[model samples]
Target: MKPSNTIKELLDILNSNRIGGVPVVDDKGQLVGMVSDGDVLRYLAPKPLGIAGLVYIIEEQ
Candidate 1:
């Protein structure tokens, strides 16, 4: 797929019963990576930005 494709499209595909996790294949269909609902959720989990920033500042000081 083109890089311009949006995550919404991928989410639609996941929601549909037409396919399972999207096969992150190369141009030759060789599996390079894979994305599923769980994978997406894990990747999109809310991070603790405030705590992370505080830690970085403290370490630098």
Candidate 2:
């Protein structure tokens, strides 16, 4: 897949092909890297705010 592909496009390719990951290529078609389903999931997953959330709450009061 091209490096410029969007997350949605990547997901579509993965799902349609029933694959876990795909190789990312540059404009010249050289292998740049690989993107796995786990990688995308981690990227899309909500990050924990932890202490930062508490600090924000305290400051707002």
lDDT per residue for candidate 2 within 1-61, as digits (tens), equals 9988998899899989999999999999999999998787556444655666656643653
The lDDT per prediction is: 0.61, 0.81
What TM-score, computed on C-alpha atoms, does each candidate reach? 0.53, 0.72
- lDDT (Cα, tens digit) per residue for candidate 1, span 22-41: 76766776777777765545
Best by lDDT: 2
Q: Candidate 2 overall Cα lDDT vs. reference?
A: 0.81
Candidate 1 structure, TM-score to reference: 0.53
Error of 1 at 3 (Å): 7.2
Model 1 residue 12 CA deviation (Å) reads: 0.7
lDDT of 2 at 52: 67
